[model samples]
Structures are given as C-alpha cells and as structure tokens.
Target: MLIVFGLMIAGGALLGGEGDSADNKSDTSAATKSGSSSDSKLKDNYHVGSVANHKGYKFKVNKVTYYDGSDFDKPKKGNRYVICNVTIKNDTDKKQSYNPMDFQLNANGNSTNMMEILTKENYSQNTLDSGDLDPGASVTGNLIGQANKNANLKLEYQPSVWNDETVKVSLY
Candidate 1:
C-alpha cells in the first residue's frame, strides 16, 4: 500500500509540472500573436483620413475649404482667415470623446498663432463638455487662421484616452 501511494504522488507531480510549462508556452504565443496583429490592424484602418507630419504629431486632414467667415454669420472679408473644416474620425473600435481644447493648429509645418480659435475652451466658455464620438464616427470642427501663400496646413488632435495617436491633415 505504501509503495502504491508513493508512486501515485510522484506521477501526479510530474504531470502537474508538465501542465504548467505547457500553459506558459501557450500564454507566450498568444501574447506574441496579439502584438503582431495590432500593428497590421492599425495600418489597415488608418485609411479613414489623410495624415501629415507636424511638430511630432500626425494631423489628419479631412477637408480644406476657404471660408470667408460668413458661414458662421461673421463678416466676410477678401483676406480673411481661412477656416479649415476638419472631421476627426475615431479609427479604434472603442468610443472616444474629444475636447476641442486638445487640438493645436499648424500651417506649413509651423504652429499657428490661432490656438485660441482652435481650442474648445475658446469656442465655448464655462462649458467643460467633451464631444462624444462613437466608434468610427467623426467629429467635425474648423481651424480659423490666416491663410499663408500656398499654405499646407496640418491639424493636430490628441485624445486624452487611448494610446496617443495623432491624425495628420494636409491642406494645399
């Protein structure tokens, strides 16, 4: 009886040890697979908009239309600031909320002096509201600034949540 009990205990330990190693190997492989696929997925879905490198951030450009400021019922001028209409899309499958204050404007790869006009805080005072964006839904906004000669503007938006990803937009 003693011999049988000892043999059973030894066999149980060997089987248990082998099972743990197998589990570890499976976990490592799963992690590796997930990491590799993540990059490819990012590149595939990156087609929602165009990207332009600006000050280390990727600015996603949606539309570039010259606005005489009359669209907002403001005075129209011959040499008024060009309002770059942009639609920032959430490429991730998760919901994203955007605060316009998180964005900065740039023209010809240089930061513009129109930071206040581009931020949400300047647009609305006393309202700390962040516009909710559904997965794959885009939030539309405008960057008001003087148009440089042959300007190529880049609009930068950085969401507080999720890994920091820049959407680049180039306007000619």
Candidate 2:
C-alpha cells in the first residue's frame, strides 16, 4: 500500500510539471500573437466622424475632397489636392500647439504629408490655426495633401511628433 501511494505521488508530480510547461508555452505564444496585433492596431485608422483621444486632445475627420488644385493654387503638373477636413478639440486646461505638418495622407499604399509651403488661397482657406489652444477650444479646417487620386484614403495623425503613437482617421 505504501509503495502504491509513493508511485501515485511521483506520477502526479511529473504530470503536473509537464502540464505547467505546456501552459507556459501556450501563454508565451498567446502573448506573442497579441503583441504583434497590438502593433498593427497602433497604425490602424479611425473611421470618419470617430473621435480619437490621445494625450490631452481629441481629433476627428469630418470630410475629404479631391480638387484639381485650381481653387487652392497647389496644383502640380499631374498632382491634385486631397483635402481632409478635420476637427481638433483641446480638452486639457492648459494650452497646446498642433502642427498639421506631422500628419500624412495614406491612400492605398501611397502616402503624402501636409505641404509646409502653400499658396495664399490654399493656406488661408484650409489651414488650421496653429496658435496656443485654449481650454475646451476646438478648431476645424482642411489639411491639404497632394495625391494622384483619392482611393482608400486615411489620415495618419500623431498627437506627439516625438513618439510612434498615432491616430489614423478615415478620410474616404
């Protein structure tokens, strides 16, 4: 009877140890899969009219328009203006500065940035006020990007230019 009891204890310990090792392997694989998906989520684009809260500001994409550049005076030989109208709200009590320069327009596999230099008409009608954002203040305007055509478009906005954290808003 004592021998049988000893055998039972030894078998139980061995089986328990193997089960733990299997659980650990599964846990590791699960964590790895989640980690990979989370990285892609960071670059994922929020839908139009969806609000994204990052750091202290709230951002939303209102509308997108494709122009011949005749209205904005930013037309190249073949390039056109894919203007994204976005609303940025400051939720924090303190003032903040938002430069639309860091954001980019992603269409399919193509990408374009907010042009730093713009003609008076394009700059005035579409540019956001980059001044100190007052508490509870919100500014809405167009962000111009030169694109061949608007297709599967999204706006990639980085609340902090220094970090990889970005919120993408669908423009189409």
Candidate 3:
C-alpha cells in the first residue's frame, strides 16, 4: 500500500509538470498570433483627410516638449521621452469623429519604426469619439512616448473621409 501511494504521488507530480509546459506553449502561441494580427491591421491602407481651408478643420502640431523624470537639474538622459501635443480643429461646420489609433507619431523620417504612445501608460486604444464638434470647435491632446532628446517629431493622421493615405505634420 505504501509503495502504491508513493507511485501515485510521483505520477501526479509528473502530470502537473506536463500540464504547466502545455500551458506555457499555449500562452506563447496566443501571444504570437495576437501580435501578428495587430501588425496586419496596422499595415492596412487607411484614409487621410484632405487639408481644408476651414479655420477649425485643420490639424496642427502645437508643441514638442521633453521632460526628465528627475527633479534635480541633471543632464537629460539619452533615453528621456518627448510628449507631442497635437491640436485638431473641426471648422467644417459639421461633427467629426476621430480615432486616436489612426494617428501615429514618426521620428525623424522613419515611418516603419513608428512607436505607439498610449494615453496614461495604459494599452487601451485612446480614441477621440466626441460625437461631432460644432463648427469652430477644437480639441487638443498629448501623445506621449520615449524618444531621444531633441529628436524631430512628426504627426501622421488618417481622416475618416479620406481613403488610406496618411497626412503628416512635422515639428522641428
């Protein structure tokens, strides 16, 4: 009876180990598939809004600023991040729906290596769905990301009305 109990305990342990390995593999495969799906979606053609002469319908890069986490005056770290505040105005005399995910930040001139900036360190999609902005209404927000100090920042936006082409505005 004692030998049988010991064998049963060992078998249970082995089974647990196998189960853990399987779970790990399953998690890794799921993560890989999830990442690939996001990549494919990003590569899809998106619409770019045309530059209109309307006073508030234009999008502008208001400012590009950097902050060092340290309070004391030390040389800015090379890895210090930059925050770009983009202002979008809706002067088309109609309501506009904007998806923040469709907006991207480009460093220097490299669009392929573009990094996503989350609103408040969360991975959630930071979209602006304020229904419609009446004529002459404007909205502003910051896109935060890690960047080299003094790096050139560009804002690329695809408007709902425009088809799949990205419009860029640079702040040097």
Candidate 4:
C-alpha cells in the first residue's frame, strides 16, 4: 500500500509540472470555459471577459463597444469605432511606463494600433502610458480602434520593450 501511494503522488507531480499551476495560472481551454494555454508568443487566451496575465502583468478587458460615425457625423460612413475598456496591472519592482501605442487590435488576421483621429478627444483613455506605474500599480482606460467588424478581435500586449513575446488575448 505504501509503494502504491508513493507512485500515485509521483504521478501527480509529473502531471502538474507544466505551467498550469495556480501561481502560473494558465487558461488552457479556449474552446471551453477552462481557457487555453500558451504557444510560444501566444501566452494565454481568454474568452472575451476573462483576465489574461503575462510576465506578472495582469490584463482585464471590461467591455467592448463599437460606435457608428453616422450619429455623431464625425468619421466616414465606412469607418466605425472599436473601443475596449481595459485594465493593466504593473507587477514589477521598478516603475513601469506603458504606452497605449504598444497595444494592438487584431481583426480578421489584420492588426492595427490605437486609433488616431482628430474628432475623438478621448481616443487613448487610461492606457498604459497614462503615467508611470509603481510596483503593483493598475490602470484602466478605454482604447479605441477603427474597424468595420469587431468580431474575432484579439488584444495583443507586449509588456516589455526588450522582448517580442506577446500576451495575446481574445476579446470575444
């Protein structure tokens, strides 16, 4: 009985050795509610409203809203606003600076950075570069993008300027 129990415990440790632990939490069920795991640059994939974390920084997307320029009579007829209410947490020892430009919106395999328009005054609200983030600091704001259909929109974040690895999140 002792040998059998030891084997079982060893098996458990081997099974959980990957990045699925609580501290290194990974949502590896993208198809289901469990979320999905990372594949190299694509760290973790969340289903729309779930929080996605990478390299200690936690990102939570609160809401996604699209506005048609027709009512406001601002943008062209074909252009629409894709706004994402997002929150960023700085889990670093040194102060960090996040530029809204560092974020990208991927739709239909095409990627675009934050929108730059003259009419909209609050395009990059509460974004990463809003201020210097102290350790454990979190900032939330609305990031805008101009696209026709906001479906299959994924939010891509590169926490550090030194590396190309990104935390790709699905904002479904």
What tens-digit string does per-residue lDDT give for candidate 1 at 117-137? 323343323222357767666
RMSD of 4: 12.3
Off by over 4 Å in 3: 1-56, 70-77, 109-131
lDDT at 159 for candidate 3? 66
Clashes of each: 10, 0, 6, 11
Q: Any runs in candidate 4 off by more than 4 Å, and if so which? A: 1-44, 70-73, 117-129
Per-model CA lDDT versus the true structure:
0.53, 0.73, 0.56, 0.66
Sliding window of 10 residues with minimal summed lDDT for model 1: 39-48
Query: What TM-score does candidate 1 reach?
Result: 0.46
Mark the regions of model 2 whose C-alpha exceeds 4 Å error after superposition: 1-43, 71-74, 116-123, 161-163
What is every candidate's alpha-carbon RMSD to the true fold? 9.8, 8.5, 13.8, 12.3
What C-alpha lDDT does candidate 4 achieve relative to the native structure?
Answer: 0.66
Name the lDDT value of residue 33 in candidate 3. 76
- Which residue pairs clash in candidate 2? none
Q: What is candidate 2's local distance difference test score?
A: 0.73
Instruction: Rank candidates by lDDT, best first.
Output: 2, 4, 3, 1
Cα error of candidate 3 at position 85, Å: 1.9
Better of 2 and 4 by lDDT: 2
Writing each residue's lDDT as its tens digit, candidate 3 over 1-172 gives 9999999999999999999999999999998976765532332222223232222356655666665544432333674555555567776766776656666666666542224344343222432333455667777666555555666666677766444545666545
